[model samples]
Target: LVQTWKDDSSIFAHDGRLNTPYSDHLLGSKYCIHAKGFEVNTARVGDSLYYGCVPVILADQYDLPFMDILNWRAFSVVVTASDIPNLKKILQEISPQEYSVLQANVLKVRRHFQWH
Candidate 1:
């Protein structure tokens, strides 16, 4: 059920090959790991704030619903795969200072929005 362009798909399975140079070509990426299965969950859970890379969370159901368990916006943005184009614009225009403000707002929401 892996979704990918036909040409891109074959090259991956040609010899149990994995990983892509495409992620490497991104504007400021230092490293990128595009993976499948349970490994995806492990990767996301393991990432830290110092990672710096803006993780484009690809999972929908488990992810979208799971955010209710904890306040995670301290370090991530959850966007659907199709909305990546608009996300790219958001990433470009959102300055570091503004991003910090957004993080601070998230903390505020976490502290105040809790149910008593």
Candidate 2:
């Protein structure tokens, strides 16, 4: 099941029971989708890395954090807005081994996203 979080609508607001803790959700999920927010970057990407959930970035021409120092592809998947329709097929094409490597890289880079 694909789980998403959006707070724009009050009807979808969590009353608490149906809500899995954010950290828990990340820990349990294999992939986390991080779309651009009002800003070019959002905390969702960092949160995904912190919990070792491979991020699927759905932003076009948006600069990611630590581009010079870190190879984002080692830990995450990036897709253009135009490719949104193919997202499922693209992700599904990733072999299990590749996914494992991505997840491992996420763990390696988790500290970089943390506040000292």
Candidate 3:
């Protein structure tokens, strides 16, 4: 999938190490991919929120940190494992106007993800 979407400007799909620092990349990007690692939850989501980047969460059964108080759908894109192949298409379908709303909401809820 990375190979197929490498040239697609809207999608920053890369396989290996990024030339730019990871934190810098997060600050510049509009969306950050938060795939589940060994655990069902990871700090990737929080990191994305901290940097004001909307999260693209790829988890089948994640109990998002603040599901009760925050509307995850407002600021993040939750993609199922079944839709991995169509990830790019799903993200692309989110118009720039909608993305702006998502990013704005990310800032609004970022404090919830902070330690202090």
Candidate 4:
């Protein structure tokens, strides 16, 4: 799915028929992949929380926001660069019971990601 999204230039292109809004995608997705960009922090994390989507962080040596205060592991899944190939396996290993707990924690921490 990720590969398809990357290949379809039309998805991001200005004149595509399926140029759906980003927020619309987030709302429909269960897990939102937060890849590392030029900056250490990105708005993708906040966007994931805003829509109640679990964040799958695919960054190496990246410091998450509010790390000192928030226990990120409780809400998000952290995958190292080398483990990219095993992402599907890792996510599949998470039982439905555990997934539910993680999702609930995501909601609990949603307020912290909000700005006044």
Pairs in steric clash, model 4: none
- Give the Cα error of residue 91 in candidate 4, in Å: 1.3
**Top of the candidates by TM-score:** 3
Cα RMSD of predicted structure 1: 9.2
Scored by lDDT, the top model is 3
Off by over 4 Å in 2: 1-18
Task: Estimate, for each residue in 47-100, the C-alpha lDDT of model 4 and write its tens digit.
Answer: 898899988888788888899999999999999888987876788798999989
Query: All models: lDDT?
Result: 0.42, 0.77, 0.86, 0.79
Name model 3 segments beyond 4 Å from true: 1-10, 14-19
Instruction: Give lDDT tens digits, candidate 1, residues 1-116.
Output: 12332354222212244376533333234222233344345343333122344334544433432456755555456655566445445465767776776545443443333334
Each candidate: RMSD to true structure? 9.2, 5.6, 2.1, 4.4
- The clash numbers for all candidates, in the given order, read 0, 0, 0, 0
Worst 10 residues of 3 by lDDT: 35-44
Which ranking of candidates, highest lDDT first? 3, 4, 2, 1
lDDT of 2 at 97: 100
- When summed lDDT is taken over every stretch of 10 residues in candidate 1, the lowest stretch is 9-18
For each candidate, what TM-score against the reference?
A: 0.41, 0.79, 0.83, 0.81
Q: List the residue pairs that clash in candidate 2.
A: none
Name every residue pair that clashes in candidate 3. Answer: none
Residue 22 of model 2, lDDT score: 79
